[model samples]
Target chain A: MAEKPKAFGERYMVKPGKSFRLADCDPRAANGFSDKDAAKADTVRDAAAIDALQDKLYAEGKRALLVILQGIDCSGKDGTVRAVFNHCGPIGVKVQPFKAPTADELAQDYLWRVHHACPPRGFIGIFNRSHYEDVLVVKVRGYAPPEAIEKRYDEINAFEKMLSDNGTKILKFMLNISKDEQAERLTERIEIPEKRWKFNPSDLEDRALWNDYMKAYEVALTRCSTHHAPWYVIPADRNWVRNAAISRIVRETLEEMNPKYPEPKGWDPKTVKVV
Target chain B: MAEKPKAFGERYMVKPGKSFRLADCDPRAANGFSDKDAAKADTVRDAAAIDALQDKLYAEGKRALLVILQGIDCSGKDGTVRAVFNHCGPIGVKVQPFKAPTADELAQDYLWRVHHACPPRGFIGIFNRSHYEDVLVVKVRGYAPPEAIEKRYDEINAFEKMLSDNGTKILKFMLNISKDEQAERLTERIEIPEKRWKFNPSDLEDRALWNDYMKAYEVALTRCSTHHAPWYVIPADRNWVRNAAISRIVRETLEEMNPKYPEPKGWDPKTVKVV
Candidate 1:
């Protein structure tokens, strides 16, 4: 038998698997879309298609989508959310940021607050920061005991499984921006007066633990990626590539769901005419 | 003073009011816009503004806005949400419909679930139906004892006041569809095949108890309308009028708040040159 052909993401039909890897696709590579010009064109087209599909999904109100953006601080999470969801409908979509739990939130089970905030049917919910914080930040910062951190992985898996079983389509994206890229972005923020408000001194402290965070994400993704809910490791150093990849992923997922307006049972269009 | 100026809506500047009467501003009247036409235009405009505002707010990581829509059944609650928020940005706006409380919801305090769902700052939250359900439906349906129903009004006032004090700009709209107009609409729904899905057999039962619901709403509006949080009585008989009135109220409120993009402190725009 001939050797298995190498995957050419641009020319080849990329069959979606239980999980996807951006590094494998390497959207930034010269061969990916012939040249930069071609890639940019593809990105615009992809973005438009995603917008259309999302609008149709909103109107139909058949499926609910959950997007989890996981990455280090300054990994372009905010920018990604803005660019990807800019053209989508507001009524059916929501973004929930999971920061440090409050006294009240801490009193409940970790997933209780999250369950309360889950998007209803026919909606899209984006978790800017998510439950992974229990394992990642709490683990790295020693806010929770080691035993507790270890247990949370199982809890997260169960939580996600329940969501999938209940018709939630989950797409987790980990924005992988290199340390050098992050430093450059942070410097630009500081040097550009208009962007100074985005800077926080504490982010530098978090940067020191970058490797720890990566390891945490790798383990999280490995343990949590399933047929119903999958994680995509997106190369986020290039904003255009990041946006294009996310748009494509979202479009592909939505296409798989094939959401359509449900005609009520026994309804006959011929029975009544529009006035 | 000159005879209190005939208390007609035309005499006023049409500035957004916290409260008003439905009969005074019917859009369909021979005036420039019938209530229905006006409401439609307002819905389009409000949807666009919300889209723009949501992007800015989400990026800024500021506070959230909760808009509550309360009206009689068939008073265009669903229609208003569908129209007014049709073009809004996806990331920051969320709409929740509080249907018959599930066993889980009933177990908690009346506001427990609602407080948990309030959008984070810089976001927009819409309640298709809201906590007012407790006062309106429970009272009308006799779900709660009279004493409990009476106490809920105070609880609602306090809860809403707390939301306003905490930076949630609450704009509640009570769609005042008249009895005759509702009958006409219900007839149209039954006659039109496409609209039949919207009509539930139970609506007829609810329709029979209109006066009871109206009384409960009056109480809710009187008690809950405060300095920070206010209610607007929208004429629902004319869909366009109601949409327009609600949109104008929101626009005026936002303008009053003056939601400017927060300039980064200590940042001089002149000093930062774009590369």
Candidate 2:
């Protein structure tokens, strides 16, 4: 009974079965943080904490932490990763960035690549974009029929629940950026010489249907946010705010898990000596 | 041509179609470096250089580096990874450690799981152990018939050639440690408090067949070392020497690749402005 209660981001968690609306969450909200520099400092500390905790988790070698980041273009998925995992060693963490499904991927069920990329035990996996895209982008673009899309919500939920049951703790983050914020970011990508390579014209098409994507995201967040795997809608308009919030929650969740390095069996350290 | 020649570790690479002998290689040879401390410093610098080159490689997203490490138990495979990749980010490097094939993996051809785990473009994939095991352990243990074992060398060579044709550069290392050194390391594993968890009683069984394993390695290396995918025999009696040699070779290979940040297409940064 000494173990801490399971961690949940009550501040941003989309309650299961609740009436959810994307518009109700303000993308620019800073969660009461008025100072940008101060929030950035907090994120730095949280990142270091996550790095330390990850070592213990790896040494324990019993479970995994799967962090899923889902957002529209220019919402800063890559930026969040750089900010939050800057201190974490690459040894125990893997970042799997999902793009449009390849021909091989399309042949399999939607979750095939996803299940394959799930973090092995004792590792942390970051999905830059994830299975939720099957419900979000695929739904908004009508890549699948309405009936097929309807079935995916439960299917994804069940898939994730199974992962949770098998010792993978899942944290889903919806990087909720306002359309105006996204427009500025997209424009910045074109203007900045270093960022120009990332500015794809196709992103403009996705921007055009922002409202439809929002509704799709709303359904995904509402239906898939279960007790085992919750979705936190991060206010990602400000880079510092987004980094601070996600890192805080991630570090807190890892601390709650409280993984410990296991003791060696059938060997007495007092009697053993390297010669 | 302005490009430098493709990098090869002339010191250790097994020459194709040449009379080869594993016995001719000294497991304790220092490769001319006398000072362990000096060698360790070189490895540190090489690790940093590798880290910087890896960023450009990831940016280029054109090819992959597959490093295969093969050795008997307690041969310092894990130690080499830690020393060489200390500075590289997890974003661009993936370490896939192969243990015994599971039921699902055994259901497919031996290379099925290996192909599935091949690094995608712009990443370095380290196989702690690899497909070479199918020939080595299976051959020495007599798990397969002599004819079957004989055919695998050619099958593996053809498979590796196909991979090289498609942009995967392969480097294979056999961590050659002396029987005396192996005994010391095995004893140390049992005696050291931190390393006790790694000591397995079954490793002793393999040690008993050291001569057989050596002959098997001799045949495989002589037959399968190809132009596209070369095997290197590393003297691993000294940890610092192993790290320095491997890191130097790896850095040279990456430098030869000389990956660049790709130019953006259809976007003019000079005219673009954030609005």
Candidate 3:
């Protein structure tokens, strides 16, 4: 068999049912790209491809793309959105940001809000923080009891499978940043006057629980990543690397989707005379 | 006293306790600016100023800015966010988009979810669609019983008062796109394949209740525009006009906030030389 072109994202793919370790991926390592500038150039190229493919996908209007971004506070989820998909027509892309669930969202099953935010077919929906927060933050903050939180992994997996079966393509990216990188991001927030408003004293509380959060992330990534909706832990300490890796994966996924623009009814453009 | 310079936003501000008619503003009129190109330049300038103020606001860490955008579907809430505040650092400016209540959210008081997402001291937060949905969509769509929904206007006012008292500066913008404009927007959504996903077929159901939604918005805008937190009914049919107007209001509101950088304790940049 002929060797196929190497894929950039496969090395970072978190195999489902296999033991996943958060520490395995080096946040600083430029995995596939040779240099930062190279990474950025590739990212720009991929972002353009993603934008064009998304136009086709949007025109096709049959299937949807759901990109779930989960990571700790400074994991570049927002940055990823800006770098990769900002050019997609505003009406065609939806960004659903999940914070602590409201009383109403909590009144229902955990997936209640999650289900509402799912991209309707043909659009690209980005969940800035998602249902996985129920596992990651809830577990660390003791918001849910251990057993209850533990079961969310299966519930999430089943929920994702259902979405997959319903014509939604899901790609979950965990922006893997190093502890030092996060500290730097946090410190910059404090030290820079313009950034001060973003410095929450409570972030320190989460920083203190880093180990627990990582453990929870590890568990969630390991147990819940499925064949239908797999997880990819992108090294996110480098902005260029993170954007490049995610965009490549996204472009590949959409190319694989091979969404076609709907045919205009009745014939070729050459046969029709302009008014 | 000599007359003060006329504020750009005062013309659109909803007078507290006075009636607000959505029809009062011209959706296509480029109010204040000379032309579309001029309005866009002004918007860019205001966006830059908002960015600078937000930096100080983030640093002060004493108060927060909450900008709530409410309008019917296709009224440009998402577009406003992109145009006005997209340049702010993601960490500095947080966007909380409130969709329909989940079961858990329903169980709690409607305010339960809204309060949780409030920007902490110093950050600028944008709510794309918000708690006002209770009175607008909930009332118009029969999402809640009439008696219950009727009382929510005052309840929301008091809740917002509590937030204002606690140092969260609020600016509410009701993007007032015309019915014809909305019909045009909706038609485009249907005809344009990429735009299809954003158009829920159910939006037609809401379009059927346009008058009710308008009435609900009038009441919400009238009753809830308070001394502490006011509502601005922006002419939103033209994208440039909408962005320009909202950006001006936002920039002015932040300038009024006048967040200051904290004094460096026991030191000054000039007095203390690097070793």
Candidate 4:
């Protein structure tokens, strides 16, 4: 038999206690797969495997998976979710998209909303954007004082460690797209009538500060990519590559978790009769 | 030109202001279909159509759909959701299963949690079991006073009406299965080790009160079914027919909702250029 392919989770993961730079990674890397069509087919197969594994997770009902997707605008967070989890049933998978916080949300610490949205045991919760926004947007926009923003990386690490201790596995993906690729996508949004609604003028303001966002992402990814929750910088310039890489990582992680159907205690099926 | 088949929503809907009897509806009814395989195939096609319509619903971001499923033990609520919504992306569809209320939930009105769980505009929220439990299990188990229980039907009607008035269309399904069918299913749950975790012994206790539960459902369906939120008594003993009938109704209702991508205002695509 051919040697097993290396797991994407290990290949793309941001290793803890290591020197890292966002610029060192290629946004358009194919991650070893050369053909787009073949990668797409593998993505579909991996997604189906994820769905099957999710069924066992649901049946076991003892642990949970929390997937966090963070990226720049038009980086395909939504598209990756649709491609990777399309085969998983709604019964077991949830997607929570974090946009602007409400007045109630802003009243509390930043993690309040994110914690409440975390998947309970036996479910897979995908965060479209997550608590890292506190570090990324807040640092870039100076929403918080520099001192407060600087302390959040440790706070986030501790929080994720607690969830890990409690049986909730976390996977974070930062969809890395080239500046040129983002420009093409933003342009397409303007030109396509059906896609026009997604085009926001404010996105251009952020586009001007791309370098600042990149620096913020680098700091966040490097500081918080701990053993409990690692961040993968997905090469997202190509939708197929992005989907395939994430799907493989997600499938491999679920397989490693290996949730099983629990045996009924002290009940023999032969003895139990429905009246 | 071929005349279109009448929508399953109209065919199975329990009309408001009409006397309804649960006994009159056959648990094994295939609606109009005779062949199980063909009906199953149509169900798969309808499910895909629902997914396509749901994409438009998400893009429109102006309206929502809430599907409420109420059923006794072994009536196949989970199975129906998996079959009808397997094609829908997690981004647009959510399944909220309402078990026994928590102490905090019990502190508020029964409608409080249900209201909070209602899908925001641009999404489909499915309740595996819902506020009807206040009228079903609560009534059958004598969890509330007769007077308190008596008022919930109208209160629920008003609550659903308010949601409908605020851009959330509601579809309620009562998964009706014969007593014999429930017994068979419950038996299988005991015999299959993979399914054993789902087999709770308390389910038998509820099964014993089958008649009372049936009466409770009849009253709730009769009193709470309204113009804004009609109740559909789905014949659910046969999983294929149950899936087919409900998928047709869900798709037809979404098609009628006719969500459209919004036309962008002020900015012309021709004038805007990506930097």
For each candidate in turn, the TM-score is 0.71, 0.81, 0.64, 0.95
Interface C-alpha root-mean-square deviation, candidates in order: 6.4, 3.9, 8.8, 1.4
The best candidate by TM-score is 4
Judged by whole-model lDDT over C-alpha atoms, candidate 3 comes out at 0.81
Q: Clash totals for all models, in order? A: 17, 0, 17, 0
Worst 10 residues of 4 chain B by lDDT: B1-10
**What docking grade applies to model 2?**
acceptable
Give fnat (model 1).
0.41
Winner on lDDT between 2 and 3 is: 2
Task: Grade the docking of candidate 3.
Answer: incorrect
Clashing pairs in 4: none
Candidate 2, residues B97-207, lDDT tens digits: the string is 888899999999888999999998989999988998999888888877889878889999889988888989888999999999988888887765556657666677789
Question: Which candidate, 2 or 3, would have the higher TM-score against the true structure?
Answer: 2
Clashing pairs in 2: none
lDDT of 4: 0.90
Interface RMSD of 3: 8.8
Q: Summarize candidate 3's per-residue lDDT along B61-153 as a digit string, tens digits.
A: 799999999898899987887788765635467677798889999899989999998988978888989999988888777878888987887
True contacts kept of each: 0.41, 0.32, 0.02, 0.86
Instruction: Tell the DockQ for candidate 4.
Output: 0.72
Task: Give lDDT: candidate 3, residue B67.
Answer: 92
Q: List DockQ for all candidates.
A: 0.26, 0.26, 0.07, 0.72
